[model samples]
Target: MSSFKSYFSIIQVLLLFGYTGFFSCGAGAQQMASEVKEVKAPKLLFLNYTISKDTNGTYRATFINKVLTEGRLKDKTQRQPLSDAGDIVCIQYNDKNDVLDRSYIKNPLQPIVEYVNDDGNLEKRQLNLNSAQIAIKLQLQEATSSVRLFLIDASGNASTDLITTSIR
Candidate 1:
């Protein structure tokens, strides 16, 4: 009877330790998750640009000297633009409510440039930082009268609100 009591006590202690260890690990995981900060996307400023038709009757748009703001634009008062260096920029162009093309620029010190090729695909080209303007050319499809641009930072952790251009 004494041996039985001892075995029962040992089993109870083991179970208690196992349960405590499990809960501790779970709590630690939760704490780690809580410590992780959410990344924000960068804001984009579409500066002076133009959409014109080429000789072939194809619609093309050029985005000149677009600016990318690093952090969130909470209000008109608080504008946190990235200084010194530039972040990865991803731009998406939509026409006729359809995604026409997507471009990703890695660390663009110059203007973030994009263009549409003859094959009707949107292409992103790199330019020199000293260049006056970063021209983004987008090919417009048939029945796609207007296009909208969306900008985001490809680098992980920056949350960006939807910075859209006027339908044009």
Candidate 2:
């Protein structure tokens, strides 16, 4: 009887140690996976603007732009309108003094819309104009770390003063 009791106690001790080791290893793997996932950055930071045509054949602009942070949107504002007739210019400048300027006709204005979806997420759709220009701007901003945008009118006036945003 004493021999049997000794063997059973040894088995119980070994089983307890094995169970603890298995759970600790699993917990460590989960922690490592979370650390690896934390290295990735957010996907996109979006800006919304509206470009419309005025009676004078000039362009008018209104925008509500925001930044995406930690799966949430912030820094939203309704900007003042810019009414100017002439060629419209979209300029993107970076801290490195790199600048990209694109010009568009005042007529046949394109509208860029940004709205919240049913899930309370921000969504964007560009109407009328080719999206290539905007895509380029977004790419440049991502590459440069930070970017400042300016919309200029045909009269060489800035339609919207130095709108800036940064991406993660």
lDDT per residue (tens digit) for residues 1-168 in model 2: 999999999999999999999999999999998888444453334455555545654444554564443442232221223445433444445556576423233323455589999999999975655222232213223344444445555576755543454533
Number of the top-ranking candidate, with TM-score as the measure: 2
lDDT of every predicted structure (CA atoms): 0.46, 0.50
Mind sharing the TM-score for model 1? 0.29
lDDT per residue for candidate 1 within 87-119, as digits (tens), equals 322234444455543433333345558999999
Model 2 TM-score on a 0 to 1 scale: 0.31
How far residue 11's Cα lies from its native spot in candidate 2, in Å, is: 36
Scanning candidate 2 in windows of ten residues, the lowest lDDT window is 131-140
Worst 10 residues of 1 by lDDT: 76-85
Write down the lDDT that model 2 would get. 0.50
Model 1's alpha-carbon lDDT is 0.46
Q: Which portions of model 2 show Cα errors greater than 4 Å?
A: 1-42, 69-92, 100-168
